[model samples]
Target: WRNTETSPETLSDSQLRGLGIVEGADGTINFESGIVVTGRVEKILRRDGKLMLIGFSNCSAKQGDRILFDPTWGTFDMAVGERISSVFNGAADKDAYNQIALVPKDRTIKVPSDENRKKLENLYAQVRDIRDRKVGCDRLGEIWETQQAEHAGDWLLSMQIFEILDEAGEQNDLKQKIVTFLNQKKLTNKDISTLIEWGFRLVTYHKVGLQTAAHGA
Candidate 1:
């Protein structure tokens, strides 16, 4: 690897290929220059059963720039050595990559199949009709803090929605924030609906401030 003005942790073609940093494969994420990319480890060239070469399948990146992957699904323009370690070690908190989706280089359009749709529907149902025994009363307290009901019937329904998608790690963090709102005695059914709508909007539409205003904290 040619040593540039970049850090030693910077990714190389050989290293990326070893880690499966393909355009469509799933695995750790990093930056080449400034592009956010996924790294798919195909082989661990380890000696004595220890990991060595981390291969990649593809890289969904543009330039050979470098960026640091924040475990919170956020990225930093400048690379960080520790973050590279975290990516290789798999020590980053799971929720950090929650909001990240499978991004391909081609940016193709995909429609969910019936089975997939049904599965999503089931997840939605879980959030909507949360049972004490199912979702656990203890968990509800933690999930209520992130909900708001400014638009009437939003917060409550939103909580139900979160209960469904709680399996989604990022959404779970967001739900936990909502649950915290509930525990603070600041949530109402109306507020919940508004908050729920906002939550969905943020997830599906990516509207700015949707999550912030909902939390009210």
Candidate 2:
């Protein structure tokens, strides 16, 4: 009845008796073909560490139908359950499929509202104009170009541009404009942390440049 080597078709009468399967008895195979096959259990084999049920069915089963001994079996529902489990466990590859998961909820990047996006775009245009006119602000133009090429949606680059403009002794009017916009804009803690980190890195780079120039002098 449960021999690993016994073929389903070659099951003897004694083997059917051992499995308690009688001819015309109710047997269910959990598959896409959801029909109760009334037949005797021909043989059960443990192949690849899984129980393979071989039986003669009164109804014709399709070729690709998964044969199972019972409807309450775990493997029957594995396909549906695995998908749900992978999403919640964060084991699913985000790039592979566009599924939204509940766990690790904060991983999604919040896109700016249309009004905010328009404001940022306008600010970037003004910054570009300043870069074109200002002598020492060619670096700003390079940064803007890089942002446009790599991540046009990145609003943090605008903040960095404003910082650089203020450092370059730009007009008070522009500085005041930046300050007012920043005060009105609501930034997440993560955004604030990033700005602080970028500011520190900028300061360190400037210090290193000054040290190198002094050594050369």
Candidate 3:
């Protein structure tokens, strides 16, 4: 981890790539004994063929501990206490160092069924039409992007788009579609509770807006 006092809260993609740290690469700190500490690499600093990994561990590590990089699960055996240096040296000798490059696992894109795809396309078209008619409704564009994200297997963004639509007083077919989507999803109890809370907030916001309008009139 970079120094919080000096470094920004988040770094750009280029900066992360420059550090050779793929955010969620799996690693382990193995002791000489049979004990193993599992962790995910947050940041890496490389200097003269040496690497310094900063990450959160399942348990505390003692000084002089080194991590074994295993981006692929079965690439390194923790029982053997294989360090990153030894793995890198061996790879260098074999001229196959690219095989152990730190990178995120390939994500399999979820392809929606034909019916769902048509529905999404229609929703996107409707949002685009609304944008073309309305001059300053930025939330519509955000809704379109969120819908695309949800279709791409990021269902968490649905709540955000829901809140945006509700706040914009758009309780039309688009809002209904979002509600239906949420209902069909396997949401946790906390997620359901949060949706209810957002509903209450929307009601309160509308009530406040109505009262303010009446007073102004």
* Two-way lDDT contest, 1 vs 3, winner: 3
Worst 10 residues of 1 by lDDT: 85-94
Clashing pairs in 3: none
lDDT of each: 0.37, 0.41, 0.41
Per-residue accuracy of model 1 over 1-217 as CA lDDT, tens digit each: 2223444345555654565443345655533333454444444333333322444444332224222132343221222333332221121222212222222122122333566445434433444445433554444433343223222212333444454455334455656665565444233334323333434533442222334556886
Q: Please estimate how well model 3 matches the true structure, expressed as its whole-model Cα lDDT.
A: 0.41
Q: Pull out the clashing pairs in model 2.
A: none
**Reference-based TM-score of each model:** 0.22, 0.29, 0.28
Best by TM-score: 2
| Candidate number with the higher TM-score (2 or 3) | 2
After superposition, the stretches of candidate 1 with alpha carbons farther than 4 Å from their true spots are 1-10, 18-135, 146-161, 164-217
Q: How accurate is candidate 1 locally (lDDT)?
A: 0.37
**Model 2 bad stretches (over 4 Å):** 1-105, 113-116, 135-158, 170-191, 207-211, 214-217
